[model samples]
Target: MIKSKKLMYQIIAVISLGLAIFGVITPGFPATEFVLLCAWSSAKGSPKIHHFLHANRFTGPVLNDWRNGKVISLNNKIFSSISMLLCVCFLFYSGLNIYFIGFGLFGISISFIWVWSRPSHV
Candidate 1:
């Protein structure tokens, strides 16, 4: 049972890490949240991966800040807000449906507020 659980965790960590990497390259996808999930799963499954993520220069500070406190850097906040706004604009122009547009706007608004509410990393 323990071994299976560890394997499951490792699988989840790897998948989350892959998505996180993709998110870094993609415009709208959020990477930080996926990295946090990867780190959490790795901690349970593989110490090696956990240590590496913690030590990594690019992702280390982000993971550390988020783990220690729910902090998002000012730059990240700005970028995410802009990206979300752009997405909302696109959704509005898409003309899928009034209900869909309203739902999308509502969700985006909530996400925008949550992201901005987090403490900005200094």
Candidate 2:
């Protein structure tokens, strides 16, 4: 990779990885998608980071499942669904504008559908 391109990939890897870690703790935030992004970028920019992700006990299985066939386990699907539901409930009760709530509901609905559509196994 060109120097600039490599640097760009490294930046993406670092940012996405950080978000992934954050998502692990934050309800309604996404981890798998960010981890996938980090892994893909790191593969091109920093093999060491890529290796570390694969070797990680928590992240490794998610990455492996994704690589196999974009599988999202049943437990994870259930967890995500509950998280989204809670987020939507919070939004409605938080007294946000109706338009903003509608927009959030729309986005959450789409995300819910996509996550459920993924296979549970290869």
Candidate 3:
């Protein structure tokens, strides 16, 4: 990759990783998704960063399972599902537009099904 493209990808990876970290600290944020995004972009932009994420104790297993078989462990499924549900609940009570609530609920329901549908890493 050209220097500019490399820098762009690196920036994306760092931003995603930052968001993933923030998700860890904040409730109802999807950390794993951002982590996966960081891994992918880092793989393209910076092998060292990819290796670091894959070697980290907290992140390695999830990355390996995903890379190997697109697996989502049952524990992770439960955690993510609950988080998503909580977000929807907040949306329902946020007094936002009915359409916004409906859209959020619909999206969460689809995502919930999709996440639960993934094969577990047995």
What CA RMSD would you report for each candidate?
Answer: 2.0, 1.2, 1.6
- Which runs in model 1 stand beyond 4 Å of their true positions? none
Give a tens-digit lDDT track for model 3, residues 1-122. Answer: 59999999899999999999998776567788899999999998999889999999989999999988899899888889888878877897799999988888887788788788889974
List the candidates' TM-scores in order.
0.82, 0.93, 0.89
Q: Model 2 lDDT vs. the true structure?
A: 0.91
Stretches off by above 4 angstroms in model 2 are none
The local lDDT score (0 to 100) that residue 19 gets in candidate 1 is 96
Ranking of all candidate structures by their TM-score, best first: 2, 3, 1
Task: Supply candidate 2's per-residue lDDT for 97.
Answer: 94
Q: Give lDDT tens digits, candidate 2, residues 43-85.
A: 9999989999999998899889999999998888998898888
What local lDDT score does residue 117 receive in model 2, on the 0 to 100 scale?
A: 99
> Which ranges of candidate 3 are over 4 A from the true structure?
none
1 against 3, candidate with superior lDDT = 3
